[model samples]
Target: MRLSRRLEKLPPYLFVEISRKIAEKRAQGIRVVSFAIGDPDLPTPPHILDALVEASRDPANHRYPETEGLPELRQAIARWYRRRFGVELDPDTEVLPLIGSKEGIGHVAFCLIDPGDIALVPDPGYPVYPMGTVLAGGEPYYLPLREENGFLPDLDEVPAEVARRAKVLWLNYPNNPTGAVADLDFFRRAVEFARRYDLAICHDGPYTEVAFDGYRPPSFLQAEGAKEVGIEFHSLSKSYNMTGWRIGMAVGNAELIRALRDVKSNLDSGIPQAIQLMAIAALDGPQDCIDEHNRVYQRRRDRLVEALRSLGLRVNPSPASLYLWARVPEGETSVSYTTKLLEEAAVVVTPGVGYGPSGEGYIRLSLTLPDDDLEEGLRRLEAIAHGRPVRL
Candidate 1:
């Protein structure tokens, strides 16, 4: 049997490698503490779960749902957007619920990019951006997200010809792996750039509600003219601890939403009706869970920041997102340091290079582990710092 060329071109998924390493260690009877993935350790709120239970029991919810989502869910999403970001959306044309934002993020490439087209993908970004473009047979033009530039891609540096040929500009904030946040001013500039280049902007914003220090992240759609040229993908995964529910939405340019909807309609079934109802509950119900979850993540971020600093690893304590990006200690590459921690401390952290070439010198630690595991991971790190042997 022959595999497709696209499958051959696809690089190994980052998290899959991390999981493999963890399984290998565990199979040897070594208990590992991992800060590798940005999945929330918290449970879904009771009210949201209750909504799912009730919806699941309804016979109507068992049938195939509309690919565009339930009208009530769409309206709820629009209402939430207006309340949260002051960005009004047309529920009928602008809001399209997703199985998860990842699904839309991947499928949007097919919607916008033809074979041999170009996508401006940020280096050190979520791997899905470039991978999706690749799967669609589009070339990815990597824009380095250097720390010196606040991790924002410098649009001016892109060659004129490359910009002209690019069909999509992929962005994320608060960003994955780096925990970098972008404001509306930057988003406005991005909108202008996209307009000039005639590119569609895809902003992955799953971490917006996961901010800390009372700092709220802005929606790309909140920028003037952003909705004219871009779409924002948001998920209930981080905010409502609903990752397992597989519910999310894309809101913005009606044309882009419709294109993505068309791709989705052909490729897969829509989000389960019960899950859509639960997502609606997440959107319209009390928002206090978001603040509560942020507080917990904030505490963990602080503790991890302190621990990493004491070990002489340079980390900028970010104001948002579920990760702390830290430069590895001098003389160690990301993979080497990651391997060292795994071997010596039974700790698993994601190597930054897994994100992109620009991520080579760093490692990313997620703030989504339980407090007990976090403390133990800290102890193990401290043990390594102090030149003491881990008990294994």
Candidate 2:
């Protein structure tokens, strides 16, 4: 059988492949404690669920929903940005509801990129960024995000030849896999760079509200002139524990929004009306739930950081997101290190190389498990460090 050349060149997703291996091991009686996935473990708030229930019962919601989402949901998202970040948006044109930010990001690449076009992506960044570029028939020019640069890519280093052909640049603050948050100055510089290169900036901001300390993650649009060169993708998954609902939004240039919407219209009819109604509730309802959830996550983060450090692993406390990005000890490859941890300790973690090439020396441990599970995982990890076997 023959497959498209495009599909042939695409690499198998590392997470799915690793997860399958873990599942097979567990099937053979090996216990597994998975920390590889960054899925939020919290249940959806009752009010949001209740709203969905009520909406689902309404006879009017049985038909197709608006592709752009209900006006109420759009307005709610606009109000959210205005109130939280002081960045106002025209709900009608600037905000386009997405099934999830991942879909929006992927489709943006499909809509904007063509064969031979260049895309600037960060090394050690989200895997989807480069994969989506390839799926769209574009060439990716990786801008390495290294620890030496605080995990932020330097735009000045990109060659003029690549910059000239680059059509899109992807940015993610409170970044996935790294948990590195970008400051206002960094955003400003990014905006300037995008404008100079005449490229569209797709800013992925899912982890903004997952921040720790007193640090607040800034929206790309908050930067000077960001509106002209950037569109920001926001998700309800991490912020409101609405991951399963698959609701998110993209807000920015009207032209870009329209282009994305056009591509989406052909591929999807949009999420269910019930979900959009519930999303509106999520956006407008009291947000104290987020504060409470973050508090729980913070406690877990503290405990895990302490435990890992005590075991001689230098773990970096993530300021945002549900991940702990830690460096493996000397002489261990990322895949080998994570595999041993999973098999010996029953604690599954993400190999950093799964994110990108620059991630070779690290692993990402998700904090989505319950406190008891986290504590148990830590205990097992500690036992392994002390040269004792973890008996399941």
Candidate 3:
């Protein structure tokens, strides 16, 4: 049987290729120091685990769950949003749980995008944004996020005609790959742009709570009138180190939430009830755990940033998220530099080209590795800088 035309248009998934290469290296008995994926290496906190253990013992949780989400879980998310971002949400209408933020990010396009419609996506942003748009038979119009613009997309740069045709405008921050955070002023402008263009603003917010050095990234819903035109996705994957739990929430614009739920209802049975119960504990439980974790990430970030800088590479220090985006030497491609680091140093990193064309000269390194492994990777990087004829 022939594959669907949409499936045929898709390229091999980027992360799959990264993981394949890593597996190949490991097969050769190479202890590759991986900084590829954004997956947290930490375990879920005991409080959440304990909650899940207790909740799972109940037969009620073993059955099918509401596709919209658990009532308590939605309420817990609402309360968490109020306390964290000062954004109030109606648990019943404005919030929906996701298998993971990635699922929600990938599916939101199907809710709003029609065939041949446009999706405005950030260059060097999450791959899911454009891929999802393409899968839904929609066009992806890239909005370049250059370093000079503080790695934020400039609204004025987008052609007015493209914006008019766009059904979804996706934004993420404490952004992926780049680790750039967005401010309220930017969100306000983006909200206005989406409102004027009749686009659905989809904010992928997994890193909303993953910040450092007293930096607090604002939620898209916090911007004035954002709830009228946007939906923001949040995941326990990053903030709570519960990646495997497969639970997250999308909040804002009740209509958009309903649209996503309609699309999801046919495809998924909702997250497991036990996971939602555990998520309640994650949201309402002590947040000090996140703070402690961020402290570790901060230390890792500083050491990595310092290591990159000493090698004469230009890198903007990331104040949030678990990544450091560093520019490669002049005239070097991202794939070549990253491949060299992998081969010569046995240190695995993500090539910026994997993110998008605008990321051609950069590479992203994750801070998810343990301190000792990270230190060793840094030492290896330092050795390369000294012994090799690399462009620093």
Candidate 4:
């Protein structure tokens, strides 16, 4: 059978490969403690699950759902924006529920990119940004996010011709892989850059609520004129321990929201009504769960940072996001360091290079593991750091 050229061009997804490696080790009867994926180990809040159970019991929820989500769900998302960021949104026009933010992030590419169009994607960023553009017959012009730049792209460095040809700009705060946080000022600049280039900005903000140290990440829409040129994708996955629930939303420019909605309407049905109810419960329900979850993550982050620093790996005590982006020991590449930890210590971490070339010297460890597993993993890492052999 012949595969499409696009499919041929795509590389294996990063997380899937990590899962495969983990399975291989587990199959061999080896116990591996992984800090690989950023999936929360915590449970969804009880109130939200109650909402799902109630909704699921209704016969009305079993049927196919509208591609545009329920009015209540959209309104809940709007209310969330207003209360959290003081950003007003027209639920009917600027908000669209998604099966998951990943779905919206990928489909939004089809909305803006025509064949041969360019998307300005961040290097060492979310794979979906570039992969989605490629699948949509668009080229991705990668912008390197250097440590010196606080992981924010320099808009002025984008060549004039490239900017002119680019159709979209992808930004993520509390970013994946890097655990980098961006301020509203950076977003304001991005909004200006998008307007100057006539590019639509696609800001992935799933990690916004997964912050630590009392740091509240700002929404892109909070920036003046952001609604004129960009849409932000947010997910309940990280925020509410709802990764398995697969409910999220896109909000911002009305036209962009409509375009994405139209694309989704034809491609697939909307989120399950029960799940939508759960999401509404999440958004409108008590927000204290977020603070509670962040507290747990903060504890884990502090312990991990101290351990990594002692081992001579450079890692910041990230203020937001459920990840610790650590530089590999000198003379080791991301893949080599990751492989050493997996094979030698029976520990698993993501090789940063999987995100992009600029990530070649780093590794990302997730803070979403259970406390016990985290301690065990740290112990193994310490054994390796101290030049002691790890027990198989």
Please write out the lDDT profile of model 4 over residues 162-239, one tens digit for every residue. 999999999999888898999989999998899888999999999999888778999988899999999999999999
Taking all chains together, the TM-score of candidate 1 against the true structure is 0.99
lDDT of 3: 0.90
The better-scoring model by lDDT among 1 and 3 is: 1
Candidate 4, 256: how far from true, in Å?
0.8
lDDT of each model, Cα atoms only?
A: 0.93, 0.88, 0.90, 0.93
| Pairs in clash, predicted candidate 2 | none
lDDT of 1 by residue, 344-380 (tens): 9989999999999999999999998999999999999
Which stretches in model 4 have alpha-carbon errors above 4 Å?
Answer: none
Question: Could you give the C-alpha RMSD of every candidate to the true structure, in order shown?
Answer: 0.8, 1.1, 2.0, 0.8
Report the C-alpha lDDT of model 2 over 64-157, residue by residue, as the tens digit. 9878898888999999999899998999999999998989988999877999999999888888888899999998888888887889998989
Minimal lDDT window, size 10, model 4: 1-10
| TM-score, candidate number 2 | 0.98
Clashes in predicted model 3 = 0
Q: Whole-model lDDT for model 2 versus the true structure? A: 0.88
lDDT of 3 by residue, 1-392 (tens): 98788987787898898889889878988778888888898889999999999999999999999999988899999999999888899999999999998999888888988899999999998899999999999998888889989999999888988888889888999899899989999999998898888888999888878889999988999999999999999999999899888889899999989989999999988899999999999999988999999998998888888888999889877999989999987777999989888888888888898888999899999989988888788778888778863221
**Each prediction's TM-score against the native?**
0.99, 0.98, 0.97, 0.99
